[model samples]
Target: MRIPAFLLAFSVLGGCAGGMSKDECLYADWRAIGYEDGARGASASAVSSHRQACAKKAGITPDMNAYLAGRDAGLREYCQVSNAFSIGARGGRYYGVCTGPEEGAFVTAYQQGNQLFALENDLAHAEHAFAAAEKRLQEINHNIDHAEAALISPATPHLERVDILADLKNLNEEKQRVKRSFGPLRRDIDVAYEELADYRAFLAANGPYPGAHSVTSASY
Candidate 1:
């Protein structure tokens, strides 16, 4: 479920393009905007986006001092290890917002959660590939049946029958190849499942972390 980096960049650019509306800029609370951004773990420089938006839309400049103060307060709410882990578990990108003594612990927890995300992603991919292979095998079998029936039919032309025989041979070979893939694919899925389960158990045993509501409701 992780978003691609390029897509994330595109979303950011898209947001910039749609920036603040004139009404929003006219009535903006820079401190609150800063707080929201900080709580979301955006970099301090994100204020520049607001500045540009307000400037373009309403000819108003953001109050830098108030915004930075609110952002600092908001960062306190966002830079928790528990929040970092939750973000990583959900396949969210970290923007290196946490710093000082907290950064190490935050990064470590995020890495562990990201590992779980990787396992989940791998299992999903394996399952999809297995399903695709099975579907192809079924299609190949169906084609072989039709080819076999055609080859035996009295009305089938001699030249067409020869071509059908060759097609049938190729289909059977491809079916075997597809069948051979099942073992490895299943093994990959099983391994991924086990890894995911183990990680979940490890997190459960070690955590009584703050709940989502508590994390989100924290004061800026």
Candidate 2:
């Protein structure tokens, strides 16, 4: 069987990394996993079937450990491919995608994929919270503005003026709390976006992820 030139180079590098040749490591096999740019439209069971089909074509052993590992290795290779484009040169230079070996790459790939997923979920949740908070702040601002307008009127009664002043003070305190929350909330969102963008770049350049995409509910 003829191996790709990239795989040959990967093997040479792997040897320097104190590992087996890329061929022995299954790096090429890992990269061979489809990085579908489009969503898998298939159901979970169907996707599993597709994985089986891929495994068969790749000549991977049927052992569960090896199967799962290969899937993870594929994810890492996909990330590497995606990141290459994201970090590429302005003139359109790109990194060569790895397509060799299988050894320990799967573990790291699977772990990073899972971590990225968790970060994405957290980001989604934070966005919802931020939206709610922003809406509330806008409402408060409107109320405060109306109150200030009333306070400026010559016809404003003493009792009513006192009430408006108190309300303003309370709103200011609430705004301060909201302001404090924004720092952390924004940080969380930023982290999530970074991780997600990395994953997305990987997918765009490489292909679709192995599993399902996350879905967020409107009310969440």
Candidate 3:
């Protein structure tokens, strides 16, 4: 069996996920590898990368015919609107693998799922920003209290008192600025939650994409 030259030449692996490990490569089944990628809706380009991995690790040559056949079977599992929705919900990228009537429907459903994902992420980001801002506010308040204590101390020098007061002023200004942003952040969170709810309701009414055969670690 002839191995592809590109597989033998490239040793560096990057963005080539779920390729054969050293052990699997030693006893490689290229068809099964292809099937897994197809099932996961991975691009056709994955074959070249996987071939490289197995070649570099175990000096094994892939049977391209078997791998192509397996991938075709796997594509049957991947090409469905329901699977597309799930993939988008989990923030996975689609490679537009399906042809025929299924492609249009799958892309439509996937877009809605992607919208939900975006909203969810936006809400999460806003919440994190707000929490971090609030934490900073608390830290500033704590510092101000300490500075106040130092100012009242009879042993404290005049210059130190002046500096402490100036620090307190700056901290208060920053606190006010953060406080101003809080309302907008809350609004953003609320908007995202509403949009997410709408998308969820839509999918709930419209979906469950087609593949009933679940992919598992054992399959890999």
Candidate 4:
């Protein structure tokens, strides 16, 4: 899509305790951090992770008031239709950060983008599964062929020949299993492509959501 310079997705690595580094805890800027988090569409509860991180590592606490103020300002920037659209296209989730008209507009756009992203993901995953299954089927068939040849070999022992027969039977079963799985994967790919086409047609007819300027974090 037509992504803008400022609307680019920024990487925000966060996990337990907000995954803040020692340096970030020591040099914490509540306002700036709040702004960044807000821009990234972090939920209000997200601050708790930071709070815990800071408290655990540095024995300090975040400035809640300052952080909230900064977050509000950042949300002002993040609550834009254009940013929401980009976020959705990139398969990003919204945290209900925007309110009022901005909230409705952003969410609407985000959902549209998310639809396309989801379909693309399904298509990719289905394709990958189908390819992997095909490879496995080939391997099983080759092994079965070799086993059959060995079974009839004059040098093969009777007991060993019996084992080979069993192996061949199991291999055939596995091949059947893979073929069964392939059917679904193939179907999934078809469904994904169809849905994608529908979405593309809708977009072409309606155009993208109207763009709006909002402040968002470099990472959101």
For residues 137-190, could you state the per-residue lDDT of candidate 2 as single tens digits?
898889889889999998999899999999999988998898788888888788
Clashing pairs in 1: none
Write down the RMSD of candidate 3 (Cα, Å).
8.3
Over the stretch 12-60, how does candidate 3's per-residue lDDT look in tens digits? 2322544568887777676776666677667888887877787788787
Cα shift from native, residue 2, model 1 (Å)? 22
TM-score of 2: 0.39
Best by lDDT: 4
TM-score of each: 0.78, 0.39, 0.80, 0.81
Ranking by TM-score: 4, 3, 1, 2
Query: How good is model 3 by TM-score?
Result: 0.80
- Which model, 1 or 4, shows the larger TM-score? 4
lDDT of 1 by residue, 89-183 (tens): 77887889888887888888788667777777988898999999999999998998899999999999999988998998899999999999999
Q: By how many angstroms RMSD does model 4 differ from the true structure?
A: 5.4
Predicted candidate 4 versus true structure: per-residue lDDT over 86-189, tens digit per residue: 68888888888789866777788888778768877887888888899999999998999899899989999999998999999999999899988977888988
Candidate 4 regions exceeding 4 Å error are 1-11, 14-17, 21-23, 176-185, 210-220
Off by over 4 Å in 1: 1-17, 208-220
